[model samples]
Target: MTFVIDRYPCEESPRLGAMILLPTAESVPRARRWFRKFIAPYNPACSVGDCTLMISELVTNAILYGRADEGWCVRVEWFREGTSLRVDVHNPGFPANVRLRRPDADDAHGRGLLLVDAIAESWHSGPSAFGGTVVSFVVADAWPA
Candidate 1:
C-alpha cells in the first residue's frame, strides 16, 4: 500500500517555537494534537480549542482549493512573536487576489476567514516569495469574543 500522508512532530519543542513544512491530510489531527502538546508544556491551562478548528479549516482549504501535485505543500509555522501565539499556513498557489465575501444566510461555506478574523488576535496574508501564499495570524493567550 502506498501512503500519501505523513507528519513530523518535533520532539524538541519550546514554549515559543515554529514548525515550517507541509502536512498531509492525516497530519491534520497531529497538528491539533501538537497545538495542545506544545502549548500545554508551557501553559498548562491554555484554551486553544478554537485554534484547532482554525488550523483544520486553514490547512484543509490549502489542500482542497490549491492545485494538487507532487510539489504541493502546506507550510504550518507556529511561534510566539510577543504576548501572542502566531500560526502561519502557507500553500503553493499562484498568487491570486483573495476577495473576502460576506456569506448569505443560506451559504454553506466561505466563512473560514471571517471566523479567523473574529477569533484570532490578528491575521493577514501575503506571498512567501517561494510563490506560495502565507496567511499568518496571532492568537493571544486569550481571545475576546
Candidate 2:
C-alpha cells in the first residue's frame, strides 16, 4: 500500500491538504490521522470527533466499494470554504453504486452513509472529474470566528 501526502502553504491558499491512499482497509485509519493533524492547527469550530468519524466511514467505503482494482487508488482532499470545511474522497468505482439506504436492523453492513448523513452539514456523491465516483461532505462553522 502506498501513501502520498501533499501540503500547501497556508498563506497561499485555503486548501488544507490532500492524500492519496491505496484502496485497502489500512488506509482508513491513516486517512483519519492525516485529517486530524491537518485540521488541528486551524482550531476548527466543528466537532473534530464527528469529522473524524465521517472521514473514517468515507475512506472505508472507498476501499470497499469504490476501487475497481489495486491499481485504482483513492484520493482524499479538503479545503476551507468560508467558515466551512469540505472533504472529497475519490475512487475508481461507479457513482451509481453510491447511495443512502435504510439498512435493516439485522443487517451487519451498509450503515456508513447513514452515519455520514446524520453527521455532515451536507453530503453528496457523484461522478468524479478524473474518473469513477467522488463522495463529498461539508462540516459547517469549521473555522473559528
Task: Choose the strongest candidate by TM-score.
Answer: 2
Model 2 Cα RMSD, Å? 1.5
Model 1 C-alpha lDDT per residue in residues 1-145, reported as the tens digit of each score: 2122223344354225444435467657766776666665545223578888888777766666555466566667666544567777777764464445699989998888788888887888777655667777777754222
Measured by TM-score, how close is model 2 to the native structure? Answer: 0.93
Error of 2 at 99 (Å): 0.7
lDDT of 2: 0.88
Against the hidden reference, what TM-scores do the models get? 0.73, 0.93
TM-score (C-alpha) between model 1 and the true structure: 0.73
lDDT of each: 0.64, 0.88
